[model samples]
Target: MRFATVEEPDGTVRCGVVESGVEGESLLRLPAGTTVLDLIQAGELHAAGERAQAADDAVPLAGLRLLPPLDPPTVRDFVAFEEHVEGVVQSVSGGAGVVPEWYEAPTFYFTNPYALVGAHDDVAVPPGSGLFDFELEVACVVGRDAASPTPDEVDIVGYTILNDWSARDLQRREMKVNLGPAKGKDSATTLGPWLVTADELLPYRDAEGFLALDMRVAVNGVEIGQDLLSNMGWPFEELVAYAGRGTRVRAGDVLGSGTCGNGGCLAELWGRRGAQDPPPLRPGGVVEMTVEGIGTIRNTVVAGVELPPVRPARVRPRTRKRTS
Candidate 1:
C-alpha cells in the first residue's frame, strides 16, 4: 500500500493512502493524527489502509501538500554502492580506492532527521555554502525489531527516494579533521512522493534479493546521473543488521542507501569538469530524483538565511607542566 501525509484545506495535516481515479490522483484521508509512523509502530498498516479506503472524504492530490512519510526518529545513511564510493574516493584522493576496512563492514553516519522535508518542498542552501549539491539515493523506514537473526525477515514499512543535500566545500574541509560530515550535511534531506510497501517491490527483487530499481537524478530538467540499485555492494539488510548490532533500531528509524553510481554532485563532477568548476546550485534551481517502485521528488533550491564566512580565532601554543 502507498501512504503519504497531506495538508488539509483547513490547515490541518493528515495521513492517507494514495488513491487513483479518472481525474489524476486523490488521497483517502485516514483518522485524525494517523501518521504513517503510527501505523508502522502498531503493525496495523493493512488495517489502517482498509479504514482509509472506506472514508467518505477523499482529497485531490494536487490540492494537498505532501509531507515526508514521517519525521524519522533516527536517520542513518550508508555507503552501500561501490561505484559511487569508488568514483568519489578517487576524485577526492587522486585515484585512491576504498580502504581495506571499508569492505569488512558496512559503514554509515547519522544525519539530522529534524531537517527532513517532504517531496515538492523548497530547500534552501545553507549560508556561505559555495558548492551546494544533491545526492540521489533510496531510503527505508524500519518497522520491526532489528535484533532478529534474519534481519531481512524484519518488517520493513516502506521505501522512498532520499535527496541528501550537501555542502561540498564545508564537507571537504571538516572531513579533513578526520571527523564525520556534520555541518555540511545538516541542512536538509528530501523524502517522499509517497511510501511503497515491501510487498509491492517483491517482483523487482533480483535472484540475490537486492532491489533492481533504477535511480536517476536531473537538475533543471537535464539528466546528470543514473544507476541501478542492484549495484550496491552491501544490501539494505546488511546495513540495517550492522546498525542494530549493539544498539536498537526502533520503528520510524530510517536507513539510506547512499548515492548511486555517478550521481554526480559538484564534488564528483569537479574532477571531470576541468578548470571550470561546475556552478553550484543556485536559487530556484530544480532537482528531481526518481526511483522505480518508489516515485519522483522534485525540489526547488531557495536562498537560506545568510551568514558571514566561518572564521576561527588563532590558538597559542601552551607549555606543558612537568610531572614528578
Candidate 2:
C-alpha cells in the first residue's frame, strides 16, 4: 500500500492511503490526528489501512499538498554504493578507491531530521554555498521497534526517494577539520511523493536478496544520473541492523542508501568535469529523482539567507621564560 500525508484546503494535514482509480487518483483519508507515523508505531498498519479504505469522503490526489510520508525519529544515511564512494573519495582525498573500513562496515552518519521537506516543497540553498549539489538516493523506513536488531528483525515498512541536498564548498571546508559535514548538510533534505510498501517491491528482489530497481535523477528536463539498486554493497537490512548495534531502532527510524553511481552528485561530477565544480544550482532550478517501485519527488531550489563569515579566536603569543 502507498501512504501519504497531505494538506487539506482548510490548512489541516491528514494521513491517507493513496489509491489509483479508473478515473484518476484519490486518497482514502484516515481519522483525524492519526498519521502514517502513528499507524507504524501502533503496529496496526494492516488493520488500520483496511479501515481507512472502507471509509467514505475521499479526496482527489491532485488538489492536496503532499508532505513527507513521515518525519522519522532519527535519520541515518549510509554509503552503500561502492562506485559513488570511490568517486567521491577520489574527488575529495585524491584517493583511488574506498577506505578499508568502508568495506568492513556500513558507514553512516546522523542527519537533521527537522530539516526534511516533502515532494513539492522548495529547497533553500544554504547561505554562502555556491557549489550546492544533490545526492540521489533511496531510503528505507523502519516499521517496528527493536533493540540490537538482527537482519530478520529489520522490519522495513516502506521506501521513498531521497535527495540529500548538499553544499559541497562548505562540506569541503569543514571535512578538512576532520570532525564534521554538519552545517554543510543540515540545511535541507527532501523525501517523498509517497511511501511504497516492501511487499509491493517483492518482484524486484533478486536471488541474492538485493533489489534490482532502476534509480535515476534529472535536473530540469535532462537526465543526470542512473544506476540500479542492486549495485549496493550493503543492503537495507544490514544497514538497519548495524544502526541498531546498541541503541533501539524505533518505528520511525530512516536508513538511507547513500548516493548511487557515476552522476549521483556534483562531487562525483567534479572528477568527470576535470577537477572543477559542477554548475551550482540556482533559484528556479528543478530536481527530480525516481526509483522504480516507489514514486518520483520533484523540488525547486530557492534563495536562502546569506551566512556570516566564520568567527576567529584571538591568538596571543606567549613570551618564553628565561631558561638561564
Candidate 3:
C-alpha cells in the first residue's frame, strides 16, 4: 500500500494512506506524528486497507501539500552501483580506470534532511550552478536499529524514490582538495510521492521480478536514461549488510541505492564527456525519474542567485613529491 505525508488546508501535516477510486478525491489525514515510518515500525500496515475503507473523512489529495514520506532519523546515500561508480571514475580520471579503494567497501555520503522536498515540488538550482544534474535512485527506510545486523536481520521498512540533485561545477572545484562533494550537494534532495512498504515489494526482490521492472528518466518529455532494475550488481540486501557492518542503523534512517547504471543525467546524455562538454541542465527545464511498480517524481528547475565563495584552509607546503 502507498502511504504519504500531507499538509492540510489549515497548514497542519499528517500521514495518510493513498486511497484511490473514492468519489471526491482526498488524502486521508491521520493524526500528527503518524508518519509512514511509524506505521511500518509499529507493524500497523496489515490493517491499513480495513482502516482506510472504514474511515469517512479524507482531505482532498489535490489540495494538500505532500512532504517526504518518512522523517528519517539519519540519511545516508550509498554509491553501490558499479556502473555509476565506474562512470564517475571515468569522468574524473578521463578513462575507464578503477579506484582501488572503491572495491574494498561501499562508499556513502550524508545529505541534509532539511533539504528534502516532496514529490511534485519545485527543485531550485543552487546559485551560480551551471551544471545541474539528477541521480535516479531507490532509498530504503530502516525499521529498527541494529549495530551489526546480519543480512537476514536487516529490516527494510519501505522504499521510495530519491533525486540526488547535483551541482557539477561546485563538485569539481571542491573535490580537487580530496575531501568531498560536500557543500556542492547541500542545496536539495527530493524524496517521495509515497513510500511503498517492503512486504508489498517482496516479489520484486527475486530474479524474475527484477527482470520485469524498467526504470527510466526523462528531461522535458525527452527520454534520457532507461534500464531494467536487474542491472544492479549489488541488491538492497547486500547494501544493507555492507552498511550494517559495525555501524548502527536506526529506524527511519534512509539508505539510498545510489544512481542506477546509465541512470544519471551525465551518463544518459554525454557518456565520458568532460566538464567543457558536460550536458548541463538549465533553469526552466523539468526532470522526471520513474521506476516500475513505484511511481514518478517530477521537478522543475528554478535558477538561484550566486553564493559567496567558500574560504579554503591554509596547508603546509610539501618538501618533496612522495612516490608510492
Candidate 4:
C-alpha cells in the first residue's frame, strides 16, 4: 500500500492512500487529523489502506501539495555503499581504499527531523554556500519501538526516495574539526512523493536480501547518474539495528541508506576526476530523483537569506591553571 500526506486547495492537510487507475492518480482520503505515523503506531496502516481504497471520497492528485510521507521523529543516515566510500577516499587521500575498520560496522549520523522538506518543495541554498550538491538515497521509516533489536527484529514500515541536500564547502570545514555536519547538513532533507509498504518491494529483493530497485537522478533534465539499490554494502535491516543499539527507536523514525555508488553526488564526481564538472547546484536548479517501487521526488533550488558571521569562540579560559 502507498501512503501520503497532502495539503488540499483550502490549506488543510489530509492523510490518504494513493491509488492509480486508468482514469488517473488520486488520493483516497483516510480521516482528518490522522497522519501516516499515527496509522503505523496504531498498527492500522495496512487495514486503513484497504478501506481507503473503497471509499467514495477520492480526491484527484492534481493541485495538491506533497508533504513528507510521515513526520519522522528522528532521521539517522548511514554510509552503506562501499564504492561511494572508495571513490571519496581515493579522491581525498590521493590513493587509498576504504579503511578496514569501515567494514567492521555500519556508521551513521543523526540529522534534524525538523529540517525535512517535501518531495516537491523549493530548497534554498544555505547562505554563503556556493558548492551545493544533492545525494541520491533511499530511506525507510521504523514501524515500532525497539531497543537493541537484532536485524530480523527491525520493523521497517515503508520506503521512500530521499535527497540528502548538501553544502560541500561548509562540510569540508566541519570535517577538518572532526565534529559536526551540524549547520552544514541541518539545512534541509527531502523525502516523499509517498511511502510504499516494505512488502511492495519484496519482489525486488535479490536472493541475498539486497533490494534490486533501479535508482536514478537528474538535474535540470540532464541525468547525472544511476545505480542499483542492490549495490548497498549492508541492507536496511542491519542499518536499522545499528541505529537502535543502546537506544529506543520509535515508530516514524527514519533510516537512510546514505548515497548510492558511482556519482551519487557532484563531490563524488569531482573526487573521481580531481576536478569539478557541471559545477555545484545553484539557484534555479531543479533536481528530480526516482526509485523503483516508490516514486519520484523533485525539488527546485532557491536563494537563501544571508546572515551575520558567527562570533568565534575564545581559545581558552582567561585564567590558566598555574599548576605544573
Candidate 5:
C-alpha cells in the first residue's frame, strides 16, 4: 500500500494513503499523530481499502496537506552508487576514483529531520547558491530497533523518494576549510509523495528486481537524468547490514541511497567541464523527481533570505591522554 503524511484544510498533519491517480484526491489522509511506522506496526494498512471507501470522519486526500511520511529516528545518506561516487570524485580530484576506505564501511551523514518537505512543496534556493542541484535517491525507513540485526531481522517498513538538494557554490567554499558539505547540504532535503510498503513491492525484490525500476528527473519539462535502480553498485540489504554494525538503528530511522549516476543537477553535470552555467533551479522554476512504482515529487524553486548565523560548535577538551 502507498502511504503519505498529509495536512487538512484546517492545517493538521496526519498519515494516510495515496488513494487516487497521481493527481486527483491524491492522499487518503490518516488521523493526526498516526506515524508512517505506526501504520506498519499496527497493520492498519491491511484495512486501507475499506477505510478509503468508508467515510467515518477520517480526513480525505483532497483536503489535507502532505508532509514527509515519517518522524525519522535518524537520517543518513549513503554513497552506494558507484557512478555517482565516481562522478563526484572526478569532479573534486580531477581523476579516476576508487571507493574510499570510509565508504567501504558504509559512511553516512546526519541531516535535519525538521527541514524535510513533502510532495509539491516549494523549495527555497538559499542565497549565494548560484548552482543549486538535485540528487535523486530512494530512501529506506527502518521499522525496528536493532543494534546489530542479522540480515533477516532487518525490516524496511517502506520506501520514499528523497531529493538531497545541494548548493554547489556554498559546498565548494566550505570544503576549503575541510569541514563540510555541511551547511550547504543542511539547508534543504525533500522527501515523499508517499511511502510504498514491502508487500506492495514484493514483485520487484528479485535478483533482477533492482534493475526493473526506472528513475528520472526533469526541469520544467526537459529531462536531465534517467537510469534504472539496477545500476546501483551496492544493494539495499548490504547497506542496512553495514549501517547496523556497532550502531543502534531504531524504528523510523532513514537510509538514503545517494544520487544516481547522471542524477546530479545541471551544475554538477556541466560545471566540472569548466562551463559557467548559472543555477539550474531558480525562483518560479519547477523540478520533478520520479521513481517507477513509487511516484513523483514536484517542487517549485523560491528565492531565500539569509538565515541566522550558525553558532560555532562547542569542543570539549580531552579529559584523558592516550596511553599509546
Candidate 6:
C-alpha cells in the first residue's frame, strides 16, 4: 500500500491512502488530526488503510498538495553503497580510496528531522554555499521501537525516496577539521511522493535478498545517471540493526541508504573528471530523483535566506608546548 500526507483544497492537512501510480489520481482520506506517524506508533496503519479503502470520502488527488509523508522524530543517513563511497572519496581526497574501516560496518550521521522537504516542493540553496548538490537514495521508516534488534527483527513500515542535499564547499572545508558536515547538510532533506509498504516491494527482491529497484537522478531535465538499489554494500535491515546497536530506535525514525553509484552528485563528478562540468545546483535549478516501486521526488532550487556575516577564524600562536 502507498500512503501520503496531503493538503486538501480547503487547506486542511491529512494523511491518506494514495491509489494507483506514482501520479496517483485519488486519495482516500483518513480521519482528521491523525498523522501517519500516529498510525504507525499505534500499529494501526494496515487497519486504517483497509478501512479507508472501503470509505466514500475519496478526494481528487490533483486537487490536493502532496507534502512530506511524515515528520520523522530522528533521521539517520548511512553510507551503504560501496560505489558511492569509492567514487566520492577518491574524487575529493586526491586519489585516495575507501578505508578498510568502512567495510567493517555501516556508518551514519544524524540530520535535522524538522527540515524534511516535500516531494514536489521548492528548496533554497543553503546560504554561503556555492556548490549545492543532491544525492539520490532511498530510506525506510521504523514502525516500532526496537533496542538492538537483529536484522530479522526490524519493524520497517515503508520506504521512500531520500535527497540528502549537499553543500560541497562547506562540507569539504569543515570535514578537513575532522568533525563536521554540520552547516553543510543542516538545511534540507527530501522524502516523499508517498510511502510504499515493505511488502509492496517484496517481489523486487533478488535471489540474494537485495532489492533490485532501479534508481536515477536528473538535474533540470537532463539525466545524470542510474543504478540498481541492489548495488548497496549493506541492506536497510542491517542498517536498522546497526542504528539500534547502542540505543533504541523509536517509531517514526528514518534510516537512509547513502547516495547511489553513477556519480550521485557533482562533487563526485568533479573528483572523477577533475572538472565541474554541469556545475553545482543553484537557484532556479530542478533536481528530480526516481526509485522504482517507491516513487519520484522532485524539487526546485530557489533563492535562500542569507544569515549575518561571520568573521574569519582566529589564529592562536604556539605558547605552552612543554606541558606535554
lDDT string, candidate 4, 61-96, tens digits: 878999998988889888898888877665434556
Scored against the true structure, residue 68 in model 5 reaches a CA lDDT of: 84
The C-alpha local distance difference test score for the whole of candidate 6 amounts to 0.87
Over all chains combined, what TM-score does candidate 4 have? 0.95
lDDT, residue 162, model 5: 92
**TM-score: the better of candidates 3 and 5:** 3
lDDT of 5 by residue, 126-166 (tens): 86677777888888877667787766778787788999988
**Per-residue C-alpha lDDT of model 1 across residues 1-324, encoded as one tens digit per residue:** 888987777889998889788998888888897888888888888789888897746878997778898877899999887777766664544455678887888888999989999899999988788788898889988888656335666557788889989887778777888897999899999989888888889899988878999888889998988889888887777778788887678887899998887754555665444432556798999999989988899999999997877789679667598668
Q: How high is the CA lDDT of each candidate model?
A: 0.82, 0.87, 0.75, 0.88, 0.73, 0.87
- Comparing 1 with 5 on TM-score, the higher-scoring candidate is 1
Residue range 1-324, candidate 6, lDDT tens digits: 899999878889998898865556788899999899999989999999999998846777886778889888999999888778877775555556688999999999998888888999899988888889899989999989999999899999999999999888888877888887687888999999888999999999887768999999999899997999999988888899999998899988999998988867777777777788678898999999989998888899998998877688789877777665
- Regions more than 4 Å wrong, model 4: 90-95, 320-324
**Better-scoring candidate (TM-score), 4 or 5:** 4
Candidate 6 accuracy as TM-score: 0.94
Superposed by TM-score, candidate 3 places the C-alpha of residue 40 at a distance from the truth, in angstroms, of 4.1
Candidate 2's residue-wise lDDT over 28-125, tens digit each? Answer: 99999988888888887767778988885588999788899997889988889998987877666566777898889898889999999989999999
Clash pairs for candidate 3: 26-60, 27-59
Superposition error at 304 for model 2 (Å):
1.0
lDDT ranking from best to worst? 4, 6, 2, 1, 3, 5
Q: How many clashes does the backbone of model 5 have?
A: 4
Model 3: per-residue lDDT, tens digit, 1-324? 677888778888888777766475467656566667676667575466347657745766887777898787777888766777777765543457457877777788888888899888888888777778888888878877778887678877778888888887777777788777776787888998788777777776775323235778888888877776666656666677777788787777888888877746574334455443446677888889887777888888887876796677779887697778
Better candidate by TM-score, 1 or 2: 2
The Cα error of candidate 2 at residue 191, in Å, is 1.0
Off by over 4 Å in 2: 316-324
